[model samples]
Target: MAPVASPTLLARLLLAVAFAAAGVAAWAEHRADLARRAEGAAFAKRYSIDVRRPSFVETAKAEATGDLAYMPLVDAAVQDAMGTVALANLEPSARKAWIESAQELTAELAAARGLSLSGLAARPGWAYHAELLAFLTYTGDRRTAPVDLTAKSARWELPARMATRLSPGDDATWGFLAGAYLETWPRLPERTTAQALPILQRAFEDPDFVRRGFGAAVAYLGVEPAARLLPKTPDALRTARDIVGKRDVPAAARLHAIWETVERETREKDLARLEELAERGDVPGRRRTAEYWLVKHPPGEFDDENGRREVGRLVEAWPEGSHGPWPRDPRAQLVQHLLAGRLASVRGTALARLGNQLTGVPDSVRARLLLAAGDRYGWERILLESGGVGSFDWTRFFTELAARELAAGDAEKAEEALSRIARPARTECDVLLVRRAVAREAGKTAEEREAEAGLALAVEDRFGAERFAGGRTVSPCVDPERWADAALLVKVASPGVSLVGYGWDGGRIGTTLVSGEATLAVPLSGLSGRRSFSIATLAGPEARASEGWVTTSTGVRGDQPEAAQAAPLPPPPAP
Candidate 1:
């Protein structure tokens, strides 16, 4: 052979070359690591206070401000729901107590330097007013819906007295409060053409009202025989659609009530509307029947105004003997339907409000979103999707929630999170597969980690191709998606050892290999140009290894002498 180069220099050259290649790799790995860290960091940085903690006397701070007279109305509506006619002992006292409280609050509300049914409308702080009104509208006594008839006289006099100071639609919060309250006034619905007429007329005309208010006004009018006079009154669907046009209503929830009504029809096909009507034997049948009715009736296309009013009247006209789910919460019932995903509009409204608050809909609502979401998944999905994560502290969000459960602590939550993060891989064999092929390949520095996090690399089998057990496995070491080529890895360590699995694209699926290691070469076929990769791992000894996943993209690994499977041989014959 020709004179060989100096071993030291040659080694140096080879090492320099190897290091150069590795440096590129290290940089990529470094960046990727940084990226994962960043995501964790960013999520961590945007902290949120945990709301699940036990109530403390020290935190008696008010959650929201601005005009909030309607809040009690909504709470009263919910409480009123307990009055379903089916009560064993109809608490006449409870009814009287509730009505009395409502009437008192009404008196407080009747006059205003600038207050009305829409007390919170002028100030956005009272968006909940719409829902409160919506709730009360459905729950309030249809026949006796008019607050004490005598109280009507007092309310009427005050509206006129407060008329000049009464805010116009320009003051949205103000108008909504005034107009909304007035719009629902049943003081003399028979006298809809006179007396309390201006309030109703004004409530509907005011543009400041949320489209929800429009639906409310339409529904309210539908109950009065005289509502037939508003020649321009649109149907419920059209009203919702028109309000949708205002661009004021959130787009996602625009037809939520409408859509649910559509779905409710199909979902509750087998469900009956009344227990007595269903001829069912169970006692809960009454509640179920009421629930079913809520599901069955939804405002549809063109049925908007009158349709809504009809539902209200149906509740109003329910047979007096048909108690139990009784004194029906026409409005609360509808919201229940909406919440149950029966009525799209109602459900949409609930989802939107909770979603907003969870995502930082401020003041009082934000603090109680979890309470509102009530540990429901759909609510959580909406909460997560809306960039709301940034609003709360991830640490507190995850940790504090743990404190309440007697079984869990904050550290336990962290452990749980880690467990959740590691849960996908099915078997230690699978974990080892990723570990041997991916994790052990190279080391990374901080600078390189930052650089690679942002770059785009073609990663095949990135999500494991939805295959059952084989193919490229996922790298738990990284976030988002990172995969590796499982074939080219050479199992140097025992089946128990783990190694870095390299994908043709350079991305890898890594975990710990408790005992084995699979050294691998850069997969050239499936990988091309700039790419990212990770060494492998098996999670940990104590933790059961979960199943693994691969990238969504299929990699084109060139035909090469692939490593044989490192299956464990059957144990030696007894002893």
Candidate 2:
């Protein structure tokens, strides 16, 4: 319009402008691509991703270029890296960023294959790696979050499900699955075992499986099953012995299995087996089993009037000093004494053998044995002497002695014993019971009422409606300052009996006793819901004692009948 030009020139000018505009647009796109490449490289370096190889970032670029063949390689490498990564070493913020980046990349790769994350996860082989990535992310998040049993179950579900899909020869996957099942067994026995048993049974039958670290899982499956699965080889026996020796196996089952093995080996006259059992300070179970055998078959005589001396002959057949493992086992020695002390003829010898080394015996056992032997002097010596004794043990010993003294019409001696107990905010129920009795004998009605109020408060603290059902039960004993966290609800079949819950607290055994079917709560410190503990019921002198108590590893729920069995309490010595 500015100049009247020829038609050809006008057409050439229009073409030139169009070419310039195309050049500018191309340059801008090139710059943008370079920027994206830089970003991808930075991300790869930050997360320790190998850019030289096909990674998630590389796979994305290849996908953009319409190359789908590299998808599987990239996916596998990414998953391998993710699984081996030390996410715990990363800062929290950095960890969050890395997890987010991984999630986005996984989504992109999954989309490239015409599938969603769920579809990819369900797919077998390399495609299943995406689910593992997702699981890794979940575990990472859990590192920073509070995890309970439910959350743990959720975390395990993915791997456990993945494990089921893997081929039978995949020992690595199976081992991991078994470990997870073992960890949650106490909390979710049925759910874990149901899914795990069939697959594990198959694996256990395969000898190749034990070449890896599958022995422990087999043991956890059960001693009988493991024994059946494994062939009778020295290596198999050693593996079984090692696995059965672990504390993870139930003590009763472990002891039984070990005893069976020992019996079999003894019948075969395997000196190596005996030496292995006598090997000091390795597996405590082996030593314990040997000690048990010694106790059952003492070196001297059988309980027979015919005096067959069969066990003594067996001991003589054993290499000199090989049968002396029981001497190293103090608890077994005390048990042997307790059994020997039951008879009047050997009672003095047993008492002398017990000699001042009463460390391994519980106060209850000591009381029972000494009272049965009518060794009042020995019983009083243990009660009065407090060296190397824990507070809980001291309190228990004094409480029992005080009760016997009070029952024997010695109020002053009972008072002296009661005074020795240090009154903490919480104590064994037996302490309060004895305190109330001592106060009554001393004719102090107010003191007796105070002790009774304390006991009532303890009962209410654990089992009251205010704690359980949000309904207040006002009583003179209610004290807000002394409330403890509710842990377990314990109920006995009979009323008016004392129950004691025992657990390890800071490497020392701590006990809480509540009388008359009250709830019991051990302090939370150094205690876990799955930790094994024993509850011992102590009734008044007339109650018949049960043979032994059962230890439970599970937490008690509302009104469960899993109360402690009563242990024998021998009658007080004659005055």
Candidate 3:
């Protein structure tokens, strides 16, 4: 302007100005976007619902049937929430502006549809309640709220307000309110059967309860309280009968009814209904109780003579197509097992021998049942009468025997039982483990001790922690030098570490707390077989491997010794 600048210079100057303005606008917009994201994250954390993705709006819209009333309200509410999140990082004036505008739009949209966040219970129609329910689910997590919402009252007020409107014909409301009541009841200060039972009963008595899929919610909410308040009363019994009849009622509830009826009425006429439920062969749990009851109190058909005949018939008619005790047709096997237990009560040891003679009973199954009965003599007889080991499930037989021996503190016997597994699943690992266990219990040969030194070194390579310390213990099963070195390695590597070791059946053997470098021994000697070892560090991230520090190793140990060892001697003589 001062000199009527050349055209080219003027054009260049205007271009620079335009770029500078664009840069400032872009920077401001980027910051605003970042603030919104932060607010969205905060919102989700506080409410347990996400709004940033925006796909929720479409899902809600799709769920809307006749009209899209819920969708608009949902959209408005989400936008207002987004605005609130965006304003969190802005200046005070900007934040105030956003709040006023968002609240105004959201309140207007809510009011236009006769919706009131504060008065959601009074809202008309299932759609309004559904809308409120969905919204509350998204925004009800108050713990992470940036501002205090306590003055606004609790979110639970909505469901509490809607409880009075629950009716039989209103399937949606009935289901929603009943479910809400069950969830909210326990957390309330003065929950009682007086207030909750009526609502549940109303839902339960509804003709639509079963067909409309409300039976589960109603039965679960009703049965326990009904039973507790008026147990064995005619009304309670009637309710129980109704609940048990419903195919949708939970097994626990049905069992409760069966037991309540049996305990209250001693007459076979009343107990006969339960017998019918048992014979139906549909609900195994119910059938088991019924059959046991019939056995205890011989009814018209199940008298002592009939009971014995029934047992004989079941045994004689053993399904030939069945391969194992567990057959697709459980009736034959179930009846037999039940009869075996019942007969034992009367015949004692004789019944077990008879059970062994049954055609369908597997040797392992018979042995376990006899062992459970404390009939070791009978169990041994079954073993002797059993099919050849080649045809039998050797793994199951040996494992069960080992567990029984171990439980009785007979580690030597347990090892012996474990050694009998032909063509063992884990060759080297199982043999070494058994050898170590046997050597630990009894005395080890000098050669065995030396061989263990090689094992200890290999263990350090395969199973040792990243860092450890060294120490010594007098163990005849292991060389002193090797033991000391291995102990020291563990001490150094496992400082401030916690180790959990699990046995074969996934039971925790023990937890080791390491304060310094290491301790010479971990309490995981006897519990070895298909084991798992896990390490957790109290402090420091590098303590755990990238994948995880927990490792599971499946090998035969503590029960099978290597064939290379000095000629094995009858499983080291069971203790």
Candidate 4:
């Protein structure tokens, strides 16, 4: 050592050096703070974000320490994330972290602001904050997100409570409340409906709120309850109707409103109002109302004066030229003309209308209309084309057509028309009458005899010979006793023609073969009731020709006839 120094001098020299270093560190921190402030100001100006508040400074300090109690932080973060590209450039983990922090901050701010009504009213920006919070809560991962204000644990009444603080004349506040409530309604607990009604009622009382299109929150309460909440005035009813008719409303709610309105209008006997609603075909609710009205008051028979008036009323009220698969069950088109007792006046129009329809028109109704219009060709075409199907009553149509053709002297066409009859058993007498006349007119004596005998069997089968003995159409050619025995005489014009006779009960009985001009008896005792007979030629030039007939016996005869009874014959082999 060159010179020993005193302890006080050495200590003073070290303290000076330490003080200098401390000053330099303090200066560096001050410059960093200044730079941060300047950068924040520039960001606020460039993005038009309002950060010129004490809360922003507090938010920065809290963010560093992981605290979230300020509202301005949420606003700034949302503005930055939504308005700038910086968020998109963030890495996935950083982006997630930023969003989570923002969500927690928003929840914290909403809960704090919602606790005091006076404070919420003093600051109108809280309304926007509540809206942002609702948006965030509803749009976030809803199951685990912290922002469900509607939850029982959360401040569920924040929006409604804020709405209550709004002055009666403050339309803007009312609109905000309604909009926020509407947005959050889907996630709201069902238990909240009672709580929400009062707030909604207050908001709707402001005309400007309704004018701003925020009055639609009524649907959240559902139809019946919502209807009870509305004013009973005509304007209010109309407004309710319009609101419910919007497509965004639930269909069940809309239908309920429509039906309730209809019931009220009908109960009050407000026909004009009801008709007005019915005519608005564009509104599905009103269209359903019109359909209900049509169904309840159907057009009765035209013979009654009251019924005719109803027809006229319905025709006038029909929503024509509108979107309709019209309820045509009442046959309104047909009855409308029949109301005036002027069938001729509507014949052409009826044909045109009926022609346009591919289905749904009854065949009998169309045919009668065609016949009335002297469109015989149309009637005949329908019968021929339908081929005894649908609602045409084809048996009757073919029978009538045949009789008409016979009277018109077109015997060939008459016979051809008769061939198309599906159930000849139903119209057997009518068919035989036509056939006998056709045969007599053609000078076929043998055919006329055969038809006369067939007619005799039919008459006896229907009305027993004892029931109408004198009025009988023809005498029985086959003895009544032989008929009971299921026996008949085969009298072919040519001899040695082979005949195969068949009987039917529930099923086909054994067949019997015999030569022509001989007595043929079938063992039909097993049959309980009347038996049917058919003869087919198995040999000779008339091979495979068949003729069917029914026996007039009401009971089976056990006694066998001592005639040339034929044994059961096997059918000819297939070719």
Ranking by lDDT: 4, 2, 3, 1
The top-ranked prediction according to lDDT is 4
Supply candidate 1's per-residue lDDT for 96. 47
Per-residue error (Å), model 2, residue 203: 16
Q: State residue 375's C-alpha deviation in candidate 1, in Å.
A: 38
- Greater TM-score among 1 and 2 belongs to 2
In candidate 3, how many Å is residue 336 off? 29
Tens-digit per-residue lDDT, 1-575, candidate 4: 49888899999999999999999987876675455444444433333333223356455454321112224444564443344445687678656655554545444333333322222333454454454443333333243453554563244345435444644456555555565566567776766655666656666665555444434555455556666654443345445544553432333234334544554445335344455766664445544554555554332211233333443443344443332222263443434344222333344444334333324555655564565456788886776676445332655445556667778888888777667666444335555666677778767788777767766666432222233222111122232333435433222222433323232211112223333433333433323212233344322323232221233332323434322344332222232
> Whole-model lDDT, candidate 4?
0.45
* TM per prediction: 0.18, 0.28, 0.27, 0.26
Model 1 Cα lDDT, one tens digit per residue, 1-575:
79888889899999999999999998886675454333322221221101111121112122232234324333433443434333344366544444444444333222221222434444433344443443343233222445542344333333332432333433343443445354555443565435544544454454344343544544454322323322232233334444432332222133433433544454334232442443544536544554455544443221233344434333322323222231144433343332221222222334334233122133222323353334446434544565534233232232222222213323433334222213332122222222222222223234234324322232222232232122233332221223334332222233332222233122222222334433333233332222223333312112112222232222324343222233322221231
After superposition, the stretches of candidate 2 with alpha carbons farther than 4 Å from their true spots are 1-227, 230-352, 355-373, 379-393, 423-428, 440-444, 460-575
How many residue-pair clashes does candidate 1 contain?
102
Model 1 regions more than 4 Å off: 1-166, 169-254, 257-575
In model 4, the worst 10-residue window by lDDT is 468-477
Better by TM-score, candidate 3 or 1: 3
| Candidate 4: stretches off by over 4 Å | 1-133, 138-195, 198-261, 264-365, 368-575
